[model samples]
Target: MQDLLGHLRSGQVCYSTPQGAMISGDSLELLAQLPANSVDLFVTSPPFPLLRQKAYGNEDQQRYVAWLTEFAKLAKDALKPTGSLVIDIGGAYQRGLPVRSLHQYRALLAFVDDVGYRLAEEFYWYNPSKLPSPIEWVNKRKIRAKDAVNTVWWLSKTDDPKADVGKVRVPYSKSMERLLQDPQRYYTPKDRPSQHSIGEAFGRDNGGALPSNLLSIPNSQSNDAYLRACKALGLSGHPARFPIKLPSFFIEMCTDPGDLVVDFFGGSNTTGRAAEDLRRRWLSFELDRAYAAESVVRFIGDQAPAKVLKHIEQMTNGQVLAIDDSA
Candidate 1:
């Protein structure tokens, strides 16, 4: 366990790059070096135990929990009091049995509880193309109940967790007003006084509906992106990677600009890229040296072959940003 903050205080420095960098090492070991309550948010989808043929490496399911338990402890120390931890877990099946709905939810819930984290919310990300299960009824047997959903569990250290609802608002929808009349709706707001209208209040201006626990972000380009990286870098392995949008959304919802973010199991460094695009600092730790190198190239290459543009348009509106080329 490295005391990274101790070195920072002792004036023993290494890399000085302003942009976020990916470090090659085990996340558990690297997390020990980070300062207590230093990060604004922690987000990552650790490799689920015993999910065969997955991108993440395999480990004994029981031992995996122990490793994850330690990781959770280190992550707790890394988060600021106001910060949050959003974990995306892939469900697992019973060994050699076709137990379709056997998710690790209960075990995970218990693990987080033991680690002193409070369960805040559970999001169900419905992916229409969810992997099919063998033993249970065909997931696609129903029209609306297709094999399409993942879990995004939210956890916080304290009761008064800090979140920015305004930043996470989605585009407004006129149709949502219909729900306002429903008194039984869970999110019904008092302003419109109807369940149908409650969603309209939180919708964003981008024309998309307000974000919900069931995020519809497609797993696009990630597989191809990994294949491309493997080929271009001449590497033998292709790790399962996530898109930048997935973690970026949570970072914006949970943290402010210039805050620190950490991902111990950074497969493709999507978290780091999102932090940079959103103007936040980040530090990622990956065990695979090849993946780490590829991440650095992918992150830095975008800065090159790019032209610096400035906005000279004069508008009285509050949203127009004025850019001075010096920055």
Candidate 2:
């Protein structure tokens, strides 16, 4: 296994695990080196195709689709037959127009039609804290509603990927809780108005209710350890950091502890940190060397981790970042 992963660690190495490695390089080049049928869970939020360009590179609409489709083929090869690839993609607006871009929609089609990956399910991420986007049309013109939702596509190698909904169930609603308390009174079996039958076993406690495909999570990070550490080192945090909850939900649902997780476009390495905390081995690739190096700060705890300290030294050219009590 180590020999197969040699190419993954060819670039600047920030961290290492039994089945994980973090390398700094273009993901397009790095992905090819990974052994086929190795990764169990692949997750990432690549730079969205925006009307205006972001500092981090993002190809224009049609080109982005072509690039992503080609990359999807490589991503599929890196995954096991029963593995899943969960991607969080945001919608884009047409240049200087109120109309929406079909790039995201077309990308979805290419994933199925071109790449042959099955769309297991589509999830929506509602970021309550998201600021108004496409400011011209949304705020100035007041033509469209606030663009606060992102599409999360769950694509799998096969019809059934390794997923367990029970692993990511949520707490039951108050009505369901009351029904569980007294099945005879509140939970009698009956045919519902929606033409759905309520079975007697519905009252059984299955940990919690299965969460809706739509996820409500805020992306704001005020004074977390990662931000504190980055601030102390004068490193601006990754502008587009996905909330930890977003990846944690899918990671729990699609993978088990010790499974392999890969983030091909590892901006700030949020997916890597989530996998680490979940005890799942992870491999990550980032194009930006500085961002890749600064990502090690996510590992700092109460005390500085020796591994991260060493990585910081390399990233800063021997300027060790102090992961003191502030973080």
lDDT of 1 by residue, 1-327 (tens): 133434332122111135455565667767776778787788888876654655457565656666677888888887888888888876665566545433457546665768888777787765554455542445533322234566787888776667865677675455555443443463544555354444444532343455777777666444545445445544443356666667888888888888887777877677877887788777777776545544543433323222111111111111122122222
TM-score of 2: 0.90
Candidate 1, residue 183: CA error in Å?
21
Q: How many collisions between residues are there in candidate 2?
A: 0
| Top-lDDT structure, candidate number | 2
- Please give, for residues 1-327, the per-residue lDDT of candidate 2 as tens digits: 356567564555555544455677778777777789988989999998886778778788868889888778899998999999999889988886788888877888999999999999999999988889778778888889999999999999999899998899988889989988998998679999999998988989888998999999888766256776777666686777888888889898999998988898887888887887787888778787777777877766334456555666676462333332244
Global local distance difference test of model 1: 0.61
> Which residues of candidate 1, in runs, are more than 4 Å off?
1-17, 51-55, 100-103, 129-147, 174-209, 222-237, 301-327
- Candidate 2 lDDT score relative to the true structure: 0.80
Q: Which stretches of candidate 2 lie over 4 Å from their true place?
A: 17-19, 223-225, 301-313, 316-327
Task: Give Cα-based local distance difference scores for all models.
Answer: 0.61, 0.80
